[model samples]
Target: MRATMMDELHKPYVDTARSKGLPTYKVILKYPVRHAVTPLASTIGWQLPNLVSGSAIVAIVLSLPTTGPYLLQALQGQYMYLAGTFLMMLAVLTIIGTLLSDIILALLDPRIRLS
Candidate 1:
């Protein structure tokens, strides 16, 4: 991620900022880092579900009583209602997180918009 953002920072727009007499830190922050934040924000938003699901595996290993392990158990047992509810919770969280990231990115980067 840092490498990708560094590549973005090296683009011509950052040079333009440098040529316009912007200081090194200011130029880097205002130009490239600003652009880099969008994808990072979106990635973080999408990864929320992974964090939730990953913890389930950890909970199982640690013998912790968490929803993730129980959710997995429910699915394995063919408990449709319980499984569906857990799935719905995950789906809603994912959608909401993405929506929030999109809104924030749209606000920060005028080149993109949410219709």
Candidate 2:
């Protein structure tokens, strides 16, 4: 976010907005901040899978009653149907996350079109 904002702040459009006498807060929020959010939105989409995978380890270590441990148990026991269901759920969740991010990106930036 910091890097993206820094890059955005230097762009000519931001400079143009500043030159137009917009207040600092308005200029920053209306320009660089809007552009800077794109990367963060995309990062959120990418993190969904990681979050689910990480939860499995965390659940095992903490001895929690959750889907993560159940998934691991199913896979270890060669329960193909149960294991496949879990895997399918993860895949669907990842696809949803990606689709949502694309929609959000399209809304945030004029250059992106859902087409």
Each prediction's TM-score versus the true structure:
0.81, 0.86
- lDDT, candidate 1, 36-109, per-residue tens: 78778777778877766668878988988778898989989999999999889889889988988888888778
Error of 2 at 20 (Å): 0.9
Q: Any residue pairs clashing in model 2, and if so which? A: none
Query: 37, model 2: CA deviation in Å?
Result: 0.8
What C-alpha lDDT, on a 0 to 100 scale, does residue 5 get in candidate 2? Answer: 97
Name the runs in model 1 displaced over 4 angstroms. Answer: none
